[model samples]
Target: MALVPMETALQRLLEDVGPLDGESVPLKDAYDRVLAESIVALRTQPPFDASAMDGYAMQGADAQTTDGELAVIGEVAAGSTFSGSVEAGQCVRIFTGAPLPAGTDTVVIQENVDRPADGVIRLREPTAAGRNVRRAGLDFTTGDLLVEKGHLMRASALSLAASANHARLKVVKRPLVAIIATGDELCLPGSELGPGQIISSNSYGIAAAARAVGADVLDLGIAPDREDAISALVKQAVAAGADVIVTSGGASVGDHDLVHKVLTREGMTLDFWRIAMRPGKPLMFGRMDNIRCLGLPGNPVASLVCSQLFLKPLLARLGGRTFHQDIRTATLGAPVSANDHRQDYVRAAIEERDGQLIATPFGVQDSSMLRTMAASGGLVIRAPFQPASEIGDPCQLMMIG
Candidate 1:
């Protein structure tokens, strides 16, 4: 019976929630997945001291002078090793990635050496000891931690894991969200509209929002306003192993609102219903066993706004990621009259003037108008029972675009 505060509802929705179970996937398919466990290097990088450039490997002391000369003993290319050791006055032609000869401590680049004869080479410039040489385990050694748990596997992380000899990775399982739209007057998009009927668009937007937060979505399509039809889909969502079930419409107290009755019968314990926010006051949240159920309003704008405000964060938490709202401070560009019992989230057009953000709310903010919601850059928050405000007053803003 009472409207729940926005903050309290969010806290309840996320209470005790955490990352899902881990699943092993191939390295190629692990991109963008969160690591479930830390990755340790199995083998050392540059297992042996190797050459970093095409050069001649010899003792550093032997090539200290510009006139230094040494007899070419052997040639070592990448993926090949020199059997003989380098002795004084002797050098080996070594290509990039070739292991350093046993007795060599440095590599004189080819540009700094001139071939005086078929086997004799003269040094034009001296190279430092260990120059142009990659020491063993230069990048990482065995047992080194390559990546930590909960890290997102980006391109760089994937490459690092591969270099650490990891063929597969343990990643967090993406949370699955099952969506059901309930209404007698709702039809899928591109369908011929009957009298008093409208196209079903909330599920599409809700599904997209769910996916943007690392959730896998299963759209169960529209269910007519009947207890059996709604309950059947709810069972399907549970059978499909959905972590969360989202229902649009049938949440209010109207005669046709049957979601509450069916969900309670299906073992969902109502946590809270009705938020102290405009456009989305009819929001509902509950739980059945391990599955979370969120009943959103029927209006398109309300559905989208509630998704951005609540659903994204809940899904992100379940997927082993953190989500933060982009809230900022701005000045109201136009005067606004405000005084109400419910908090208002007035969608506004944002612009930057003289390095300050200016938020101008659209003239009409009907919950059914989707075009205005799409054109808004952010929402200007107004507290309940607040006084009328003039232009240039300070306001809190939540950026949506």
Candidate 2:
């Protein structure tokens, strides 16, 4: 079968992904969750026209001259209301957030005023109407949509909603991603390993990627390369209410590769297998009972790259958050060879000189190596079957964080 193009595979994967179900959560826990619906203000901010400064609230005309003196009819602090009207040359001593008494149109800050006697203060600076005042609904009025649907609840957004009188918010449910590692030659990390065996490491990276997008993960542990063993774990992930199940290793054409067959036997309708990309050729995508099942190659680098290219965006979309690759153009600092049928994602170190991005790929391009991939800040994108290029040639790159 012809390998699927990277863009086409992504499009197909996204088409079957639906936004997560909605749930109501307390405002405190709603931060970083995607809003499921628009949040309207429950009540007007400030509730009434109030003083914004801790000083005398009086008519602007009376506070224009430094010699102006006004008898403080009464004092109003925050949460206190004064109903009596203040006439010309008479001011009310009001604290910040206090409701502006009737007939008060301006405020003179305490620093700009002088008091020579009890309840008697003189203006030392000019004040203007509406100065140091927060009018009713200045921040948000009743029935006003403060946070729109599909918005990722950032710190500022969450605080804004809370200030608008929202004690709770409706947010999309976080999808549960289940990760399973397959290989008889794998052992859990921190355990003593025998010859021909290695520590299973795919779940940790896959789960972290899912969590970066706010998705929950149910790590199903290791499933050795046995039909019954793999099937049992698949059933376990489904029973745990996982929205997506991912298996790393056993995806290639080797005799030990059994992920594709296992998923199909478990009722997964195969969408596509084998993407046209270096370090991730054996990547497989499918669905089973509406739950996504991704089969990623055993190579550690392949698994991580697939998680970044496919898993992150899939989870982000379902969580109602926007996702995009940070692709940029750069000049090659070293010569590069031609590609074959698969597109190349050469791990490279990037630097900027005079604001020009320069990409330098490591000497070795082995997909199984992790040391070089870790030192890389981005991947230099090379199209499939492209010709060789010399140093200083322009190319596109996708930044990784």
Candidate 3:
């Protein structure tokens, strides 16, 4: 089969995926969830004219002059209203958020007034009308849009929704991913190792990647390199209603590579296999009805690279969230020789010097080394069939976390 380009593979994977159904959740539980509908203000903010500062509410004409004197008739705090109206020579003592007294158009800050006697105060400074007063609907009016659809709920967004009188919100359902690991030589972590046995580590990284994009993961444990064992887990994934099925190992043409055979036997229609990228050239993608199946390479670094390049975007689209690769331009810190049929994603350390980003690739480009992959900050992207380059050459990098 001809190798598919990386862009073509990604475009095919995200062709028909979309957000799942909406579910109603409490405002407290809606954090980090994608909004399914626009939120409208239920009631006007500040429902009525209120005081913005601790001051005395009175008629503007009565407090305009520094020599004015007024009698304080009543006091109003937050959540309380004054029943009596303010006349020319009368004022009401009001605190922040308290409703302005009837017939009062201004609030004179307490600092600008002096109390000469009980219930009597003299203005020390001229006060302007409508000063320190929050008019009705100052933040939002009734029936106004507070938050738009497809927005991710953050701390501020949740607080704003609550202030808009929304106790519950409609959010898109999180996409579910089922992961299966297959290898005869693989054993669970912390197990006594036999000859030619290694711990299964791909599922852990794959699950973490899926959850980082807000997708729920179901780990199906390890399956031996047998067609029946792999097929059983695939059926279970379908029964559990997984939106995507990710399988690690057994994707190449080796004798033990049984994922492709089992998935095809289970009625999967293959989309493309064997991409043109280095380290992850054996990657596979297909669909078994509504469930999307992704076959990843056995090498640790290859699997992770494929996940960062392909799986993250697919899951983000299915979860109704936006995603874009953090690709940046940088200069090579050392000389590099290139010319190959496959695209390369060389793991490198990035540093900034004199406002220029420098990418220094590791000595080895092995796909099975997970420690080097972890220590690297990003991958320097190299196009196919490029000429050899010297030091300080311009390069593009994809940042990884």
Candidate 4:
């Protein structure tokens, strides 16, 4: 079968998967969550006109005289308000954040005045009118939009919401992904493996990939290459309320590839059965009763690459978060062959030599080689049907898991 184009597969998944419902969480716990509704401030900041400095609140005109002396009638600290009016030559000692007392239109800094034995201070510098006062609602007015819906709450955003008198926030729910591994040749980690069996390793890598994008994963363990077993696991995944079900191995056309048959039997409408991507050709995608299903190939590297290409974005959409791969342009370190139908994602180690990104492809591009994939920091992309290129030629690359 022909492979599905990259654009078509992404569009199909986005069009079919709906975002999960919103839930209310405490303001302190809302960090990194996407907001589901706009947040309006319940009260104005600097609720009352307040002083912004430690100074003596005085009338500008009263300090213009030769002596510049004014009596400190009262002391006002933060949260304290003075109702009495300031007479022509009277002043009040106020701390920072204290409400500017009634009848005081200006302030003279304590450093600029002489606090003598008598309760009086002199203006060492010329009085500047209305210089140290924070006007009412200086930060934000009541009923103003502090944050909008779909905004991802970060440290600053959460603080702003709390300052707006909100104790809780409405946020999108996290997506739960169910993972199932299939193959009779698979054995659990740390088990005594028979000569023919390999460790069931794909689920761990897939689970980490899912978590890196904020989706929760439920590992369903390994199943034999039997239609009954695969079908039962698919049904369990559906009943377990997984927003996405990722099945590793058994996704291709071999006789033991029971994933495709079981998913279809469980009502999955196959959107696409394959993709034009190397090391990951059997990348199947579909939906079953609102739950997304991704049938990933058995090869370890293929499964991981498919997760980065497809699974991340799918989970991001469900969780109401934005996701993008870190793709960059770089010059090849050595000559490479090309001219294949599948677009290749060659494992590579990227480096910077005098600020230029140099991508060196690994010697072996086999799908089952995990050591090379581990050593690689990224993938150098090679287009389909392109001729072999020499060193220093430009290529595109995407950062990996």
TM-score order of candidates, top first: 3, 1, 2, 4
List runs of model 2 lying over 4 Å from the truth.
65-68
Which one is best on TM-score? 3
Q: Which ranges in model 1 have alpha carbons more than 4 Å from their true place? A: none
State candidate 3's TM-score.
0.97
User: What is candidate 2's TM-score against the reference?
Assistant: 0.96
- Tell me how candidate 4 scores on lDDT: 0.87
Q: Give per-residue CA lDDT, model 2, range 48-136, as digits (tens).
A: 98988899998877877776578999999998899799998899889999999999888889999888899788777777767999998
Number of backbone collisions per candidate: 0, 0, 0, 0
Global Cα lDDT for candidate 2:
0.90
The predictions' CA RMSDs to the true structure, in order, are: 1.4, 1.5, 1.3, 2.2
Q: lDDT by residue for model 4 over 1-401, one digit each (tens)? A: 77887667778878856568999998987888888888999989979888888988877676555365778899999988887888888999999999988898777777878877588777776766787888999988899999998888899989888888999999988898999999999999999999899998899999998988778889999989898888888888888899999999999999899898889888999989888888889989888877999999999999999998889999988998889999988889988997588789999988889998888999899999999898888998888888898899998889883
Question: By how many angstroms RMSD does model 4 differ from the true structure?
Answer: 2.2
lDDT of 3: 0.93
The better candidate by lDDT, 3 or 4, is 3
Report the alpha-carbon TM-score of model 4 versus the true structure. 0.92
Q: Which pairs, if any, clash in model 1? A: none
Tens-place lDDT per residue, model 3, 208-247, is 8899899999999999999999999999999999999999
Model 1 RMSD in Å is 1.4
Per-candidate TM-score against the hidden true structure: 0.96, 0.96, 0.97, 0.92
